[model samples]
Target: MTAELLEFLEELSRALIASGNSVTDTERILWSVAESQGVEVEVSVLPTMIIIKAEGEVSRMGLAAQSPGMMPLHQVTEIYRLTDDVTSRRMEVGEALGELRGI
Candidate 1:
């Protein structure tokens, strides 16, 4: 898997966590999002963590704390924009990572 794709997944997982979704739900949503972006991946989500397996070789996992709170619409919109930009090659992974961190 490409580094850019990996970075995208990581940021997306973070976004979902920030949105107050359970890790399992985040995994499901992220799988759909990736597919919508024309990327295929295998994901396994536990209550406290998410595991993504890509191209049968690369795997990435993220551990999330349990912080349940509503995410503002504007923040979610920004995340969607970031996903679009990176997936469409309009932005670099590093740049997107920086933006996501700020969010």
Candidate 2:
């Protein structure tokens, strides 16, 4: 996988965690998102971290910390849209990363 893809996966994990998803739920959701976009991804969710393997080439690991409470619906929806845009190629990795950071 390219560095951009790796970075994207890492950011995605962070977003999921920030959106109040448990580590296991984050892995499941991310895998489903990738598969829906026709991408193959392998995810391993540990007690405190998530590891994403993509394109059979690169693996990116990130810390997983759930927010104190539920995230607002709007923010969760926005994150889902951003993930879709990135995985579907509707947005560039850099652009998606920027948008995610802003969120």
Candidate 3:
């Protein structure tokens, strides 16, 4: 299921590029689709990048195993939000450092 989802995002990315759509416009379209599909995405914009995450209230979202009785952290990074569009992408210097350290 995840592989299929990744493939779908890749194709969607390609189509967005082919259509000459800007990232901002793409995000708007993406939000519209997500709303209809019952997925919630929160966009955090940096100077030249955007981070997408699933929406949760002030409570009820986290990392960890997510088993019925598992406890998760309150930290944001550990939580993951699925991305439906891959056309919008960026990497961070801190993440690069973590990769360098084999984290």
RMSD of each: 3.1, 2.7, 15.6
- By TM-score rank, best first, the candidates go 2, 1, 3
Clashes of each: 0, 0, 0
Model 3, TM vs. native: 0.35
Model 1 / residue 74 / CA error / Å: 2.1
Q: Model 1, 13-89: lDDT tens per residue? A: 86777776676777776676566556788877765677777666578888755456778899888887887786676
lDDT of 3 at 77: 21
Off-target runs (Cα >4 Å) in candidate 3 are: 1-10, 44-51, 56-103
lDDT per model vs. reference: 0.72, 0.76, 0.35
Q: Judged by lDDT against the true structure, how good is candidate 2?
A: 0.76
Per-model TM values vs. the true structure: 0.67, 0.72, 0.35
Better of 2 and 3 by lDDT: 2
Q: Give the TM-score of candidate 2.
A: 0.72
Best by TM-score: 2
Summarize candidate 3's per-residue lDDT along 41-65 as a digit string, tens digits.
6643222333445555221221111
